[model samples]
Target chain A: MNQISDLITAFLEQCERTPKHIAFSQDDRQISYQQFEQRTKKVAGYLTGSNQCIAIAMDRGIDAAIAIYGILRSGNSYLPLDINNPANRLNFIIADAHPVYIIGIGPCPENINIDSQETQWLDLRDLLISDFSYRNVQIKTDAIAAILYTSGSTGTPKGVALSHKAITNFATWAGTTFNISQSDHIASLAPFHFDLSIFDLFTSLSCGAIVSFIPNRLTLSPSKLTQWLCDNKITTWYTVPSLLSFIALKGSLETRPLSDLKQILFAGEVFPTPQLIKLTTLLPNVNLYNLYGPTETNVCCYWPVITKQLQADKNIPIGIPACNAVLTIDKTTHELLVESDNNFSGYWQNGKLNTVTFKPQGYATGDKVSINAKHEYCYHGRLDRMLKCSGYRVEPAEIESIINQLEGIETSVVIGLKDITSGQRPAAAVVIKKGHTLTHIIKPLRQKLPAYMFPCKFTELSAIPLLSNGKVDYLSIEKKLTH
Target chain B: MKPKIREFIFQELIFVANPDQFSDDDDLLEAGLDSMGIMRLIMFIEDNFGVTLPDEEIDPDNVQTLNALEKWILRHKK
Candidate 1:
């Protein structure tokens, strides 16, 4: 099981050794390693075709898990699509990726401009029930494992293509670094589309540990999330910092002793100092880690937040790079450049953008970091207009593009305002046409954007203030919000 | 049980239309209440009504509409 060449091999080896052990679990339902192997094999059998990529639009459950493994087992890469996303965004991804098969429970999106002749819709439930089974399809190490789409600054969603090598490398590094073993019950909190899920999925599988997924419905309910951790006896937990904060403040974590919960790894955004302190106070014995990286580079740097280290400084460092990752700061702009084998291959189908995004060494993370006297990387802030909202990476320009499309909207600017509860939320300020009220464009805006992208608040202005360089005066806008 | 909850929702979720235009049966999610909005609404309810909502009570059947949320508040009230 330790001879990890690729994810499929690592998973299969685990299945061979611990066939009866539970690999994944949902509410009451558990899928053993043997059952997971067989289910994925059935999916792989159906996936035998000319299609190189399969789009999975299933709900966040065992079906989605099986479909992903099945795609990999069939020598095809998976493209995880959130069916909850607006029809426009889904359709756009389908058109761009040109996935040969879409496995999900929902009806086909209307006006889907994909080639109906080539594209086949495989019902996930039917596949789960089917008896069709096949052996693993050999996949090249360099071949893509998955393509996770992220918000692009240029209006269109860009897919970050991760290869089998890249994923396996990171998983190996994480599994060893964290000492994730069969005894650990890992909690899979993030969705499949998000990169955080990769660590949760692979690290658990690689170690032959049980990966318990927190239901999407329960994610918003902080009390339920903490309760789930306690009930499942999840030893190793990895998720966004906001979820931890929510549980600490809103949920009843302090009331009960979650003795089984040992490690809490948080990433995607800066954990608020006060909230982190509160969490540490509650879970005194728990090992806390701050994992940092964009989708393109998985988790490159990790900080083990020891209580002694925290008593001196309120700011948590991003810490040293992972075994396979190298981080260098640009002397000019202080932008963080991450070089790692875990770096994504490139953006899907956007060769022009890919050249700009990926360097020969690694990917250019738009985040800026400062090195302290401790030689640890401390997150300053994002250099670009992109924002991390409720653990999702968002490009403000993308929101602005959607806003500008509305009739009677002259110009719009979206900014992430710091919030005590949910890290940062997007707030939009706009200037509208003379006759139009705010109500006229809000509905259309909602139709186009997802909830996380929705502006927490909207402000009207006669004219959007601009700096001497003609860019929107963001400083003035922040000042206005604070006032 | 409370008009202020509805008022706060309308004010907070400015994307939604006037509160008077909608019936209690209207799906707040469909109307523009996202997951974050739901949390905000829960916080408002907890602070004003002095009620703590269980995780199981936050399902669509209990919180999707104004009527359901009102019923939830009444049931969970301290």
Candidate 2:
């Protein structure tokens, strides 16, 4: 099959063989493959051949799953909107996308008014209940599948348009690389809107693995999450490093028996070594992996945690490219370049292909990496986030990783602020553990880190500001530092 | 209830801020309670009271003062 949607039909045929097998689990609800297929067919029937851009404003549930596949079956690219986003941001995206229909699985926003463009509003439950037959339709591999919006460096959100081939390549490669099986139960930690969820959903579906979704309320609650993991017997989980750090610090993993968890994949940001160490200590059996990719490429490279020696090195290498993906580091700039089958078509609204100053041909990676003696790639933060201090160009991630090693410093952000005499001075915004002295911590941080890399200014924060996608909000920190 | 609220605020502020210097009426934002600090306070409030804070109620002013924060909590409690 050339297209990803055809693979879904294969999955459906497999479901017929194992109809009693559990397909999805959310909170207290569990849906079998048969029920899920029937519901998906109903949704597909209701939304056949709709050319209008359809926005799926549903929470993480069975209905949301149906809505996503339904839109794809109808030959329309689905836009997953985080209902928790600010009205202004949502309006900007909605206006920019100019969707013809908005599907709400739960409650639709009443405040923000849309333009008079014949927007069809449908409750997902009602749509799923409607009479419709599952018609096998042909979808081209190059056809646009989804448009995911991410915050740009300039504050505006840019939608990345992904094709069926890109998504299928990623899912197939990920399934093979991870050795995902029909018996595996993958936990969906990332929101449907985030690129992380694309692998969580599609990869699992392709392998006939059960996809379990954690409730939004218990997402950050470590204790609750621990219990959820144990209760569901979750085999695999995919999320950002920030959430993993939070869970590790809060002692969530220690509370429950996480022996069933086979794999833990972390992406979006750098996974701190200390947190990785703690995770290895708690659940040594679980295979820990660091997935590296921007939204442009779903996942280009991954470094599977092989041994403690790799973890102790402080620079956990984002391993070689997966199947159908090739990675090369620019010799001049040392920037990581990825030429992959999983690369997105282009940005949605502006119709610009790789305008972020990094894309060359099919390669669009913005990260600067250095190949080790072993030939494994070690990440050195974003090129734009790096700063030159005291004649030495310093990556903030280098100092930030060291800062996090300090006792009682829960979270740390290293930023470069403009100095009148020194050109640029590195400043750190830190969130210390309870009852820890900020001054005392910074003193030792100076000893551990170099003179130029030591934070010139130390600001004590209770928590690190998080973006909507759960990554650290560096823009907000920079704004605070400048002010 | 107000005394309890004050005590909770004092405890949380100490964990995150300079406890000895902060008074009940002290401006948290001005006294180094940044966005991250505000989020910690929100988490503490949610965990302690067993209440979920909606995204709409996470305004700067609602978390600025001890009295305002207390009022906000009480309003949500009802």
Candidate 3:
């Protein structure tokens, strides 16, 4: 069995043999195999023998890619911090990771500086220009390759440690399943921090296909996105349902028939049946796939969206497990349990592997599911405090923690309220710190949380309902919101 | 002015807003044309008109009525 290092070596060899082939594209800039490999080596050289985590606080572009590959080559895990992250959150993450090095395309925060120990700060453009040769270094399969931090249920971000073997396994499976090859051109739509982007980056690299990073501004504009897709002749598109719905609802598909687009894979949320029907009508030749998984499990199950079949039965099953991924259901609870090569080793910081939830046999996913007569598994809902409302996963604890951060909030509880129009909306019931208006508290909360995570309804309470154990009574809050 | 454009706008407004009642000049933001809904409308205009609308042109006033959208489309027509 070839290890991840072997995969990288093979890819590098292919690049050397065909140095003219385009490896990455961003805006007007394109990087060939020769240039990519040479720059990757410089990054590796700079990071080699570094026994500390490296934080990449750079914009989403070519430099970010090089830094990631460099961290991998240097035998240390890379942590990606969004350039637009709140200063306090960024500080918290930097403090938690305790990164010995920081790479930035622009200026670092003026207020907070990493002065402790030896913290080297390097400009990405300077590093890319430096000439360096590739070094021969062996990498262990189980070694941590990257630590992806996701918004946790407790409001604090948790780092998911991924191994080289796990990433390689996912890449191999994705490349083969999607029929990725040298002829393919895939769009890199998701942000670097988002785990879904890994599929776009590594899968394209493994197959020797072109990976183009779409700018964030273009992604927000429906018209620009449509033009870019058509102009670039993007063959494969991997994005969230939100963007896909934007296209469908905006009617961009009608004018610009994505004729060149052969595959459209959507994950990170439930694809609405109405929008799915519209997409099929617009692009009849394109194959649509609904991928299902959490950040922890990189695409364990997939359901091919056959427009005619899915239209007949409103509910779409998440489908069967991918190659090398095993799925089982807890007979009593019906909670989905997943065992896969792509499963993260464990969360960082706490250093406690969740062996109770995840045994050597498999990890018990908190999502509830049901198997149909055809033996296909369908996602029902989560059994935990997490809620999937309008395609974005909202952790109540995370929202509560943010609410608690406000000065005038004594305590708070966040819960999901199902509505007829929008599938579910987040509602917050707060106990204020005496003489504070709900409006005053809500204004600040909106600025702090993302648009999707914002509470649509605010209910003021004297005190947050608590259970016998003194924990916030989520069920009582839900009932209050529902009523 | 084409009635197809007006009909499309009205139909989309109904689909997105799902209001108990609404007037042609009703503010979209007030009528529940949230960020997600606005995105959907933007796509609708592009597909139907074969013209890409910029983010600056996607305000509530520009999409509140058939007249507003038709005027905007006419100005930006390729």
Candidate 4:
């Protein structure tokens, strides 16, 4: 096994050895290692900025992959902007990250709000500049590689800065643990902005495996996604459990036997045991695993599913530590604390490093947990107000903050409702003024928030429910909504 | 039947910039109707139409369009 301290060095070595090996493949397009290296180099050649932050705004494609790798090669960190996000949200990230270069033909400050005139837009169509004279920049192992944005409690998205050392360690650990090799065909199912893409884009490339990008359209019909996985002969698949659970329920696993699929890894949220059980039974030959981590720490722990001990009602145990994660449970709160080489360097916001208030030992994981007799981590909900609407971490305060700003909304409280498919969906319980109706605020509120964070249900209330100590009565509202 | 499916999809399932202009034949998946939305949509169909669409039959041909969803529901409806 080769020693991997950095991603670029590992990728360069892989390319040199197996230039003919296919690196990335999409619907009709594919790129070899040699071609990918050249393309990434060409992309790096286009940038003239000394400011080492570049924002990429494109859908999940082979080009997006090249753009990301190219940005990394240029000794710059890449921030992926989900094109589906609202302009306000995208603007907030752009303003926060202070990215000098924005790649891909996405949203621009076209007379709306040019927060920075120094911003340069490079269209995705013209990404491959003809100039070959590009000077290579040296990247330190601790240099930020990717900055991923997640919903913040303070009414906006916060960027989690991941170092090259962080990703390389995690991805290398993943590649080694999964026994991935040149022959394995991996699937990239998550969007570029999501943390799950870290494994798909980096680990597969590092292992000299062909990573195939699947589109969102195929997911509407799980059968189509299943067929694509089988037809493409994807050997390994990793994604959030919600989509996988849907596939197991609706994809007719009996008709389409996925012979080539060797293993499946689910992360970002707890897999309901019933669905996990179905996947194990349906794909009897394939191995199943549950990886546990936040975006701040990329995959700190994992469990290889033991189907014999599976129960429908019980939660799956998050396995023992991996990837050199130093874990210590908070005795008082039972909150899981993790420290590792894979832990993110820091949280970034608007050209400044935000303090995460890390303790001497580890970063507080917000989740309340119990160490079972088997010595595995059993998750109990969050210690904070954060909720996972499916795999996307949502802060009700963020949604409520937006809703309160709208007209006719006296005071809005956003709460997560129980959902079968998605773990939870954010619903708004609004206190409206006498003269106005809820309809006026709907359109504007939708524009301010992303689709995932948008409240699925809105119930109009006469007044805000309050506790004895003057706190918002969330428990009362939850009972009212469900009943 | 088409209106009911269309209403449910537009109201709760998918999000499009100009939903009113969105046609009945428009693809819901492309407009951001994900797997979660599909599951909720199936449940809605069973409750409203009193028809249980088999798990294996939840293919693109049945749920891709408003017209397709209506046909799929009506075929099983008494």
Off by over 4 Å in 4: A49-51, A105-114, A125-127, A355-357, B1-33, B44-67, B76-78
Second chain TM-score per prediction? Answer: 0.87, 0.71, 0.61, 0.89
Query: Distance (Å) between predicted and true CA of A79, model 1?
Result: 0.4
Best first by TM-score, ranked? 4, 1, 3, 2
Per-residue CA lDDT of candidate 1, range A410-472, in tens? 989889888655568888888999989887666677777877788867878888889999988
| Candidate 4 lDDT, A67-99, residue by residue in tens | 999898888889998878888878888888888
Say which docking band candidate 1 falls in. acceptable
- lDDT string for model 3 (A1-483, tens) is 254442355567568667888989998999987788778888887665643478798777788988887877777778887655555666667777777678987556663466556566777777766766556677777777677777688688788777777787888888888898888888887778877888886888777888888876564456567778888889998888767766765535677887788898888776767777777887899998988888777788998876767662375789889747899898888888889988887776632223225765587778899988878889887888787655556687887898899978898888877633234567888888877776666556544665556676667788888899998887888777655
Query: Where in model 1 is the C-alpha error above 4 Å?
Result: A1-3, A49-51, A106-116, A125-136, A311-313, A350-357, A479-483, B1-14, B17-78
Q: Score the docking of each candidate (DockQ).
A: 0.32, 0.05, 0.10, 0.39
> On a 0 to 1 DockQ scale, where is model 1?
0.32
Which pairs, if any, clash in model 1? Answer: none
Worst-scoring 10-residue span by lDDT in model 2 chain A: A350-359
Query: 1 or 2: which has the higher lDDT?
Result: 1
- TM-score of every candidate relative to the true structure: 0.90, 0.71, 0.83, 0.93
For candidate 1, the TM-score is 0.90
lDDT preference between candidates 3 and 4, better one: 4
Better of 1 and 2 by DockQ: 1
Better of 2 and 4 by TM-score: 4
lDDT of 1: 0.80
Order of candidates by lDDT, top first? 4, 1, 3, 2
